[model samples]
Target: MERESSALLFIREKSVGFTARVALHEYKRQCDGGYPAKLKKVLIVTAPLWFKAPFRILRLFVREKLRERVHTVSAPQLGAHVPRASLPTQLGGQLAPDHAAWLEHCRNCYTNNLQNNKLDGVIDEYVISNYIPPVKTQNGVIEHEVARDMTSDRVARLEQPDAMHISDPPYTCDTGPLRHTHGYNGDMKGGHIHSGDEDEVDLITRGTWSSGEASPGLSDEECAGGGAGESAGALLARLRSLGRRGLVAEYEEIRARPPQGTFHHAKLPSNLSKNRYTDVLCYDHSRVLLSQIDPEDPTTDYINANYVDGYKQKNAFICTQGPLPKTYSDFWRMVWEQGCLAVVMTTRAVERGRVKCGQYWPAAAGARAVHPPFALLTEAVDVEDDYIISHLVLTDLRSEMSRRVWHGQYVRWPDYGVPGGGRAQPVLRFLQLVRRAQRTALADLGDAWAGHSRGPPIVVHCSAGIGRTGTFITLDVCTSRLSAEGVADVRGTVERVRAQRAHSIQMPDQYVFCHLALLEYAVMHGYLESADLNGFDDDNEDESE
Candidate 1:
């Protein structure tokens, strides 16, 4: 046996038991006779912290060359050694694992070997020598094309001519100018423009709004002029003029013209308890309908969530209330059904002596939480000063199919208002982190969403799902629009969002914060000069208090 080809071996920590350890030690003893020439590296992933010392001790017993080849790494660190695009989701990679197709490939290889009279009652080596991994299709179906080299008694790699054919172009973070429209399409039906009627007055105060007095920022004169073709500098100047009071007035003007979309499902008596807030409802036109868990009860289909459009991507987010204790299962169901790879949580479980959001996920890493049909395992957690990043694997109990999900919780936002004092730097930094994680998750999806630059909708929620949720989404949309188009249209973006998600950017303070956030982002990214924002620090100081 030449054994000249190199190989990489991946082992999951959970799979290594006492018996496996004994077997591994036996193999190590055998390696003393002569180490295998095939394996170039061995990676043990998801290793517990306690295992580190043992692994070091074990390495000391191995041959010097072999010790250097063996390694242990966390899931996030694995991408540095291997390309994430080629790895499976289970390993924190883009590819979805297909064990059934792999087994089928092994079966074909075994059958071929037996027919060729090469089995000799030992099919392991023969199968290994001839197995071909299945190719994943755009729809995530596994298809195999096996070609055998009879003369060499080995499997031949098949070339896929169309492997590089991506239905949608890969998204790039370009700051120049957009070649197309960058916000919501505003095509949702069943919505009527508000006529400032008495019936609509109560709708303006649906979700929790800040009670703090408005902080001054932009001057009234500076806030007076704004239109579609305004340059980035002009937009920043206008944002600077729109002091807290001006922004509040602008928000009230927007609220007066509310696009009141009906929420029949949300208001249904059976579904009323599912909603976190009585008045904050998902619109009929864009609600995320769940497949009924009970075929006899149609009420099981309702969850208080709507699909909000993103810049150039329709249904880019599932904006919903934070899961109530009773609706945790429904929440995970929505996650599983929609193929959401990330969850952006902007509020804590409890705020200001009240429960703001439910503690739906496991409390600590290496713990499990069962939500009926689905089980979520918190694989790892990385806590930062401003946010906490959770790596979770959600497994379907019935089907045994699992998907990795990233849960990012922004913990620094005030209970009463938005983040970043006045500049919105903290919130913007958190947004950057979320976007990077989302982009990586989208890429890992491996073309499941063939034609969309933004993949499956990211689940965003707060207590009421409108105030903080809307502010976060609005910041994302406006900044993305600014990045792609070289212009920021805060009013237009909020209007488009409200058209889908009614009452988005609930408070005038949040509306003002969006303008400040966009202005800060523009100046930071060189879209506008910092000099354009002079004297804004005084306003930010006032807002901070």
Candidate 2:
């Protein structure tokens, strides 16, 4: 029994019968975990009513051998493999499905560290690290509550195996329902959150201004000199003259051209297929290549990332996707390999009821998550109104080499939309904070980050790594160009970025937002005044195009 390894997925027809999509997504999420490495086989026993349902689509994502691990069997078939005395009665076994009793047993295991302080055969401090009691809220009148009893129950039962392995400190109460019911934080209510349904109008809703003469900064040739010494009034007047519609038209012209380089082909077959979209690729010449962990194969070395050059600084960013559950280790590997000083996350891990990115780092101070040779420890966290700054230490367990990496999590900015109106100020402020930290790190640890005085290409990522990611980098590059050289070239910068990484600035609105945001930056820095910022309708911005 100690040597035997197995995993089970129970399908309660009464619970997930109608919602196949949710079931499949949940299944994929399970598959995304590190279970395949430990388990020799995974069994699926559905409710008696469920027929041999089509679950073959799952094979495409998992490894070829791991796919063979999955097996769908009936209740009677389960009894043949397991002793009736130990099996649950709900699935034709003698032991009754006593979840309440099971919870108590599991709680004891956590309360008393067993199996050499390793819970459920997995060695990790996560279960016991910072156990908190459930939040108790008394009922209030006229309160709106999303009833989640059924969903909560399903999750509790599904995770019973792993839950039994929790090894933590003393319990708040001796008895009660485990105090923890899966990882749900009560934000999402039903089904997978789709990004498509979100209201882009929640951002600044502004109208299209008539296209007049283009702004001096809009033209690549004119901007070659710089926007420096350009007065606040004059800058706003120039921006107002060019308008959103004209800038957007110019962006489309750049987008229409076929990408210049072929560096993106370095992506491996597996990594390419894993990407949410295909067109998003890393340009070959400037791509941030991952040092292969395995010498024999180079396919796995591919991480959908690239080295984007800053306005003046060469190789300013290691732009990549928001880490997937499977790519968590790889993402950290890239960070360590690239010698990055800071990680700037522009999108929330989950946004607008959808999983925009995986939760790649630890949630609190003193907590540690190990991705094999790399162990990420959250040393400290500073939560700002517009962004969260986490102090993380990455220790290479094998060589014992360690490095501190900063994570600037900006949550105010919507997924595909700009931080509009008053919101724009926070973004500018956030960028300053990130740059300040990088500068300070460079000055303090001079020789440690020797070559990267401007700091190693700060790892910037959103969901797709191109849309919001590209916009943020563009802002950083152009803003720096304006400050140092006195010019900000939207067309030139966007084209250069897309050259390194494909389909960079995602939509027309994002393209327009870049110009508007640059104008906002000018106003914030005294180059433009608040009153001078006119002809800008915060509510008239169009996303339909």
Candidate 3:
């Protein structure tokens, strides 16, 4: 078998230092102190901070410790070209002051250590290291995910497999993106293209994990080459059968209407408080724009402003073309300047020139000036990919779609300015926060629904605050209030939502997007149709596009 080898070395002669970060990577109890005969390939690195060692003796000891004894590097040695087996550090003053800190990160393992009988400042210490293994093990991350595709089995095998392992969910989450994003080409960037009701993008959603599952960072070629064991083509083909019916059931019209009933209309939880938001507009949810605004609507002006700097943010507004437009930029400016978030259409906001805000950015402000507190910038990835969503499901399923706006996550790109579109909202900073906070929220919501409800007269919004937001709200409410009622027509749900709010996503792409959103919600919770609700695997397959 042909194998490839790579190595990393770090050593600095100037301000030179040597440190060993040791961990029991593969431990067995056959006389614990014995050498690891099986560890044929090992990576060794030297730190940058200077420390004198009786290295002449210790160097020999380190060499003796290895079986194959492949990689070796020494700090403070330079002007030398050594074989692949060796690496030398540059001379003094060559390393960055933070090089040692960066080295600690290289080890990839974190721990607290006990130290005594040292200098006064030296005590027990917590340590972190980023040890890049010469070869990484399987724990793959998704590159790009769209509704029209699938993945490989070598892609599976989680530490402890569950629903999370079965499928990769979306990246949207409070804990930031639950999955790492690798490759994307803007297919889902502008917006989802409507594939027609009877036609859906074709692809596989699940795969079996045998041995040799791909690691998290392998390039696409490396992943494909990593044979994950062999399976029958028949089985693979069966899994690939295109499920033509909309992934989201078509509940074209409301089944039993709202029943004019006293639903969770009162039962929804008002768990959050007004004081919770010192600056209400500091973190704008994406649902707001997707549901409420339009370029033409005249009433979209937000009369309040509540945020940081807004005037110089370069955010363009759309409406009646007065002081503020009905655009999100205009409304968001108001949100940044004042505490007001108005319910209006995008066109109207644009026409107004400035969506009324209690506060406004200084005229000479930068985008960062009006930046929301919890907003984020991230590596973009399509949310519909199973691998991405499966990873999210493995992590925090509830937050997969709730946090960001109009499907686009706020991501940080330094020199590259943000891409613009009606549904777009800046949120990369918030994605980072979501990566950590979402899990707790999911645990709290239980399995009934993914998002925390407003309890009384709750509001759900996308960029327009109508289509995607309305659909999600409808599903969430029905799941919580009418789970017993068999799956209703999605179209019916949309119509009902429209009755409450006019012009709920007239765009075709937006319509398709609404269904996909529903699929994401249903699949994550193991509740796919009322029939499947009663503890049935229904592993039975075969769907056509």
Candidate 4:
């Protein structure tokens, strides 16, 4: 081998599968045992996000002098390191090598050398028989020069005899049943409330109260008459009657009740720094505990998140605080351990010049951000009018396995109040997009997800993980109920969520916004006529100050 030669490696995305990752890891181990003094420099281009972290970890095991020679760069940045004249046209260079001619010359030289030495007995017959010269096509293209499409037989022969055996089961990339017992205080209904049948009662009847009649609030008389039934129109009429004052009063009533469960884990001095707010704590009974990275250290399993039930499914959502700088690793660990498939972010990273949440993900497509053992790669991003959807792949460096996660961030929602200046259309539309994505991902899981009524818990977070987070969860649950049973229980849904996550619906306005969001959903889905909301004022002008 030439001592002063440099190597340039181009990695295509399709070639970086699980088997390739394992093989690369074994190669790294050999290199670390004995650093290659012959190679001067190695430049790797278009490497997958999963390969970057393990490479960095490999540097720690290699000699310091050899570490500085290896470099990883994007295609556009290659010019800064290497001259364009020495590169191939495919890699933004001026020269392209004639691979066919090079192979033919090599074969001729080998034949002459063999004839002069008479070394037929010294060389292996299998190696000599397999050496075939490159062939040219009708269009003058080298047919087998690159070996891009190698046959399985050739690959099997090339594989090392003592390859590492993987003992852990292969990751199906599908969510299984819940591993831990959920702490939901509500009744266990055993299955999903919505059957997804088109013939189900998705639309609400006009009921006894017409659009022209005065709104009948949820008074003692109405509760006894038709309010007790699961009628969507009756619920809407009661919600309209509440108006601003009644809604605020209803929120106050929920606050007055003493919170259930204790906060022993959250109050510990070691875990205090993990929480965004000192008072907004997760209930110990329902808190989601991380699988301890260090078995000896108990604090390694702490994260400010909880498992909250949705409609009829247990542990349907994992509500958590926005990840802090130190807790990014823990956030992803919880995501991986819990088998979560979706993440819904309701607040921006920065609001009013303050950092409300840390930027835990990559900033753009084809970029990656590492949080120690977990590396997140943004495969693609779709920007919409009110939100952004990211297609992400999360890789575990230790296991060399990966899973896909769908991330939806609603940017228009302000830190203090709802989006669209208290309007509900934007929020409802965003919810629709999220649900559609979730359904598609679940279906991709096939039989693993098909065995259960609901997929794994969807991770949700905002600034405090209560205000906007709670509101979004409430909206999801209430909308599903209304669609299945034609009834929206705004107050009951908020109470149920707060039972698991303390201080959920942080502000009274958020509590009222849930009702407004549900009403809009009812009208938009044809459950109620547009004229039904004629006398109702959906604005939050009188929201609590």
Candidate 5:
């Protein structure tokens, strides 16, 4: 069977050498051999020069497609490096993230030969001269905006069987004398071509991989007044010629590696009203956390949301769940078993065997709460059943917690060992806790919780109950049908958890933060790396290794 293809996308790579090499490899392969058949005008699709890796790859992948006239599409249009800044008008060109980076890259690189319709043997002949989608510029400010003439000229470069569509360069500029301006903003007021408002633009000067190096083969005649120090235009032209070569040529160094998986991409459900307050929508994680505890059914059955929105009743006794148990679980279990069940509220893991059942405890990363901890479990001790309780002794507990947090010592974390963004300490810690909790749940229930118990042992894990508990649900979702975007139907996780119990991880960012934290830790430790993906290949033929 064919293996699953990679959906891994490159946000960008920091390697200049890699990008340039790849671009050149693609370009040379493209031009080196082929039928003597005619190849029409081509559109170059690239990541905003600032977005180096993905753009380079995107550019290479689309070369053949762009060579097909009329329907050509440029690199920036593909959404690989989306412009965060909005365009000024219908015709304005999109903003690049960083101009300086782009310039620096251009300085040391050679653009593709077909750029900007440069028929001559010049490197930057393809760099678009006209800016598009205008912006307002001032005398002293550097701005990013695509020019109208540039866009029209780009369209004009396209050809059809009957007629050629083209635009004449703005004849108003000082073309006769070949004179240039120094750092004049692209505004029309004082010979500057304006794109639009500054507030609307994001700075691309910093994002572009740029340098001051001139194109390798410019003649002294061509290099003269070449903006070494004279004018931005001269400098821009010089660098652009280089940009055409490749990102490696454009960017001096690209720190190549992997993607940061700390972020979770869950679009808010469309069911939400635009004016909704707090407006946070959780997946199965949140729902499961909220419904795991039933104050009424002390013997069994964690309370679930009675309705679609939520349930209103309370006072149910239920076994609670928590983020796959760790420092927090140990703390709760020790305290609960101490015969403090009445005086101190205690929430215990559900069914005892599942690792994620501990997410019920509502606690943050810090010192113990002044209010005595509580543990509530759904497993009812029948009149005949035996019970093994837990207790906590504070013997220098505060000091240990302190050492763990501030001193960066080996301290226990839930599902994860520590909270910081490095190492797999957290995951290892979590795995340990979950395995323990699951074992305990199963032994106590005699295999009842996975669905044999006459009444499901009320797994009650608590506090506000939301984020932590939701982690389990998220995991379940992840293990389900995976998408190319690295997303899962976590809402389903929450819904399933809600069916099991009430009042799961109640705090926001807890569920999201927990998973992200674990992932961050995994990523930093080299445990997780974006796999080489084949998703970007729009071509029909398989690429050779």
Candidate 6:
């Protein structure tokens, strides 16, 4: 038997749609060199019949006639194919279970290979190894040749007859600009060129990264007027030059590394134990210290939250999960202690027939609530199409100090999913409001936002702080980077956020959505050519990875 020509997938009880897709993706991606010869007879042995459904969707994503070769059989049926001496006893054969040991050995071998840099050689063998010269730029704008090199070839390949008939892998997040195929009808240049609202545009300025020391081979001429100073056309062109798979691979590499110190104490209770309300905890180093709030009790010092720094901005946000009913007071106390000027709430109080978040704030204007040591007064409320803005006045009863906070609740973004590309206006509009509010508050502090101490972190929360919260923060930070530095690194931004808060951008789809959302934001703000923003379908968004 030619082992390279055949493959077997043994599906156990824990196999889900994500697992099946991952297996298929690995097989397809790894066997790309001679895929036609490989996997000619892929067989799946399972205990139940329902496991076959995931493979049906696999065809739509993998673009291969995998269903034709995929065969799912029960344990009783496995005996007919394998010799009685070779099969496991559970499958009515004499062999005992040894697959687990073999898998462990394979893992060790792969680890050794990776440490020896053999993995890179393997990848090099599979790839065409196009000579990507060190990119050169002029006046902060990428040279047309560089942009052409980055996009034209990929688009041309995608336009080939064989490629046009194929579909993307299942559960893939479509970051409009980074995908291999050209989604727009040939005319990439045709789109809305101007912004509808000039007042909402962000201030773009040259950033620290513009210095040659930070970016080697980039002279002042190459980065002049770069960052926020670059024109929208140049920025969009630069953004379109990135490889989607390369970005995904970098993100995966970051996830594979173990954290240096998990800060187990930062967790509300023991790390081993968890409840439905707070299953995850922030690491100690990145966690917000509230020891000053209640110096007497150490328990009061802890909250299920972490401080996430933004691009060129420290303590940009205090990311946390939805406040549990009991921790509502702690949540508010953190906001008050941290001097947060705005709260970016991405999830609704309830979602999909489940209590996703606590109704921590007052429902209507003029309503007042006393959550102990702090009293929250809802001064006013303004409801918009995609979100609600509330004027909240929080008074710290202990110090008799009162502060007004803007509560921006984005209602449309679903839990564990992303806001569709077509419906980006509301989210972008809401984000602008938040940024403006933060800027005004920072300005009032005079140098605090920029100098010795940074401005108060914006308190952002969702059902789980890591998913939608991470997505929102990533978009905000990347946009800010684009405005100040004229460039954005999606993978780097996500890695920074994750360093502060564990598991930021929870799944692969969320990670990809971050890119898509940024692209949508660019179009809305006239930074990118605006095509039919609604042409992209984010309806089936999944956090499979």
**For each predicted model, how many residue pairs clash, with residues at least 3 apart or on different chains?**
6, 17, 145, 0, 139, 8
List per-candidate RMSD values in Å: 18.1, 25.2, 24.5, 25.1, 27.5, 25.4
Global lDDT of each model?
A: 0.62, 0.56, 0.24, 0.61, 0.26, 0.54
Across 1-545, the per-residue lDDT of candidate 1 in tens digits comes to 01222233344444454333553564455444333234434556666656655666666776765665456655544443343333565664445667787677667777776787878876644444433232331123344444333233221211133122111111212211111111111121111121221222221112110000000111112111122535578876675676555677888998887444455556667888898888887765456656545645655767888776666555677889989999999999888867788999988898788998899999699999999999999999999988899999999898898999999999877654877455588888999988899889888875233324666678898888888888898888778777876876777767766766778888877887888778788878988667365664466578789
Give lDDT for model 2. Answer: 0.56
Estimate, for each residue in 1-545, the C-alpha lDDT of model 4 and write its tens digit: 11221122222222344433453454445445433223333456655667666766665675654454455555433433333323455655433567776566555545654765644554322122333322221112233333211124543643444321111111111111110011111111221111111222211110011110101111111211111234567767787677766788889988887666556567667788999888787765566756445635545657888777676555678899999999999999878766678999999999999999999999699999999899999999999988999999999888878989999999999876877688888988888788888888888875333212457778899999998999999989888778866876777678768866788898888987887778778888888785254435444554433
| Consecutive 10-residue window with the lowest summed lDDT within model 4 | 206-215
lDDT of 1 at 491: 79
TM-score of predicted structure 4: 0.57
Worst 10-residue stretch by lDDT in candidate 6? 205-214
Residue runs of model 4 more than 4 Å from their true location after superposition: 1-230, 531-545
Order the candidate numbers by TM-score, best to worst.
1, 4, 2, 6, 3, 5
Relative to the unseen true structure, what is the C-alpha lDDT of residue 72 in candidate 3, on a scale of 0 to 100?
A: 34
Give per-residue CA lDDT, model 5, range 418-529, as digits (tens): 2345333443444334334434444554311221111111222322233333343333233221211233333333333432233333333333333343344334444446
lDDT: the better of candidates 2 and 6: 2
lDDT of 6: 0.54
Candidate 4 local Cα displacement, residue 112, angstroms: 97
lDDT for position 429 in model 6: 75
User: Over the stretch 31-147, how does candidate 3's per-residue lDDT look in tens digits?
Assistant: 133322122233233433232233222333433333122223232111111111122212211112334543443322222121222223322121101111111001121222212
Residue-level lDDT of model 6, residues 379-443, one tens digit each, is 99999778898999998887787888889899888776778553556666787889888777677
List candidate 6 segments past 4 Å from native: 1-253, 268-278, 292-296, 421-423, 442-454, 530-545
lDDT, candidate 3, at 200 = 23
